[model samples]
Target: MKIALIGAGEVALCLATEFCKSEDEVVVLTSTVKPSLKDLKAEIRLTDYSVENLKKNLDDCDAVVSTLSGPNEFYISAHSNILEACRQSRKCKHFIPSEWNINIEDFPDQPMFSAATHEVVRNKLRSQNDIKWTMICHGWFMEYLLPTKKNPLREIGLAWAMNHGTKVFDMYADGLQKVTLTSTADAARAVLAVLRDSINTGADLPPVTHLAGQTLTYRDLFQLIRTRDPAWKSNPVTFVEVLTAIHEGLKANDALVAIHQMRIMGFTNANHNPKGKALEWGTGILQGLRATSVEEFLDQSEAGEDK
Candidate 1:
């Protein structure tokens, strides 16, 4: 299958690598191509994400997968154009939007980013029928726990829910809320599995697909960290504190509002646990695929550090 990836970021690169492993033709469209993208066995096309450009580029593609992400306006606009292009494409029928997080449908208008970006795309897709699309929600990326050198994900230092150096973590609703974590590589494999199944059975992909490498509460996660480092302290920000932080962050237009909101969603059971058809389908398709567990991920990180 000829697949067109709408962005050249780590997620898209991961997908390209996985798809290429099957010897499928992969074309990555991006405004700026990173050096790592050249290392992949895929064609890289430099182009703006305009509707006309995407339509022309995706004309012969069998599937379109977007991994684009940015500010609200840019993300919404780019995805809108990509969806329209897919609709008008001659052969492109399957599309996977850049929804690599939780089920935005469950919690509407929260986490400002989802409200502005994902919700807009969902609304657009609701009104369209030309393109068959599915949103893959894999909870949190386990890569965040590892350093950039140890993983394919780009580093965003100290922006994650856990701060190992400080021995502090966000305790969302008593730190008992279950949050799913999946490695990018594993998520990519699950996506390909779904696509293959859809093509083989001539069935439409589920509206939302959930893939979980490990699902554990913050308390459980802390215990795992303790297993690695016996001295690791658990200084957690209480649920009330998280709520207060979110409110204050929003008032000050703080970037941390998104993080706090994510914690709240997990606490509220709206984003953490995966259920229904989405979970069943993803788990069924990934039966034989051994997903990397949180324990395995920590072991890998430790091994990388030892080197």
Candidate 2:
């Protein structure tokens, strides 16, 4: 399919990477469009952030996927520019807006719900009657659970960034809370799938299809880590203190509710299934990369205090 992708962020790059692998023609638009899809080796058309240039380029594409990050200053503006261009393009059929996080309707009043603004943009596109739209509502990215250079796991024994000594949050199920979390690759693949066939796809207007590597809590994750490393253990904390901290932070508008809802919902939906063969394909490539217990994650390098 002839596709035009907006924004060259992680999500956009990842999706473009997968779609390119599928041998589809993709055009990536960013502040400065790279010659080819970076790191993916696909023949991607590149365009800078020029509305006039994009309109002419996208005039013949079958679908347009907006992986633009949002609810922020630049993201909103860029999408608005893209929306107007798309409205006049006359050849685009499906417009997949950028909504890779929580369900927008779940928290209509919160600005962090990024979905709200996306809905507004989507409505604008649909009103033209020339473009159909689909929204991809994925839960938290499972990859977030694993530690990265920016978000390293807590040391081995002491609490890491968590309030109190609690290893897990309250919104999590009491014991066995099973929530789905899609791997970044899986999420990208699912978006590509929706782009391929927007007409007969997932759920309603939001096109709500949840994806995940697996449905397991922090405890489940801890257990997996323990199974891999017998030296790991837990340092428990109270739910009240953590929730109070979160409430205080968000109530003061110091923090957004996106993270709060992620813990609360804990990927709880069970009926959602992952689409796109590539999502599954990528999961296998990145599997077995994590095996650290919460205790070790928090205090492994801290004061070496796991007790």
Candidate 3:
């Protein structure tokens, strides 16, 4: 089977590598060049978002998984192109949009820009019967919490939950609340499972899917981080504080500030928990690399740095 992976960044690379190990053809579709993948030999085709170019390249592919992400300036436009490409493809039936987030944030009412874009794309896909699409709502990227070898907080630039170098963390509620999270590798495994299941069962992929590597509270996360570094401190904040901010921001039409702040607030807030439409992958589905815990993820990340 041929899988056309859109995006050549780390996450895309992880998905591409995992897909290639299955003995399936993997083609990377990206406009940007990745120096990180220089040593890896694979087929990569660039896209300029031209309808003709994308349709030509995506033709005859079995699946398309888009992992593109960057500045909000061009994200919607770029992803729209990918969705269109997949829609126009002749052979590709399965498409997974870049919905690698928690199921709670998948609602259309969410004021977040990213959430809005996802809802928009999701609605557009719903009106079509030509192609099948599924979303991977795996909570937050667990990598943001894990320390990388090259840089202590290399992905900090992409994440907004924590302020990286700050020694103090103010979480909402009791901080004992758990939220869904999945490693890139784990998510890739789930995606692979979806691919196999979709092909063998001929089942229509759900509109939204969720995966949590290991559910733990904010206190557990902070304690684990402190256990590894021993200098970080965390404290609990009142939900009223966050609610006030959200109310004030929304009233002021400051959706960006309100939405971004809502992320940490919601994660720390237990009120949002237990209501998500999370997908449960039964045992033996993920196979080899099981979903890892916070402790294990840290060990792996630190161990890699030592090597």
Instruction: Identify the leading candidate in terms of lDDT.
Output: 1
Q: Rank the candidates by TM-score, best first.
A: 1, 3, 2
Worst 10 residues of 1 by lDDT: 273-282
lDDT winner between candidates 1 and 3: 1
lDDT per residue for candidate 2 within 1-307, as digits (tens), equals: 7778877766676577667776667777666655445566543555654678768777888678887775475566666666667777876756777766554334433333454566566566556655666555554454444444323222322122122233333334343544445555555556656555454453223334444445455566667656655655554444554467568868788544455433333323321233441134334322333323334434543444334
- Candidate 3 lDDT by residue in tens digits, 237-277: 66666567667877888745545454553554322223245
C-alpha root-mean-square deviation, each candidate: 2.5, 8.2, 3.7
- How well does model 1 score by local distance difference test? 0.75
TM-scores vs. true structure, each candidate? 0.89, 0.65, 0.81
lDDT (CA) for every model shown? 0.75, 0.54, 0.66
Candidate 2 regions with alpha-carbon error over 4 angstroms: 33-38, 43-50, 103-116, 122-128, 149-175, 198-206, 231-243, 247-307
lDDT of 1 by residue, 181-228 (tens): 888878877777777667667788767777777788878987887787
Clashing pairs in 3: 102-139
TM-score between candidate 3 and the true structure: 0.81
**Model 3 segments more than 4 A misplaced:** 70-77, 105-108, 148-163, 238-259, 262-289
Runs of candidate 1 exceeding 4 Å displacement? 148-151, 154-159, 275-284, 304-307
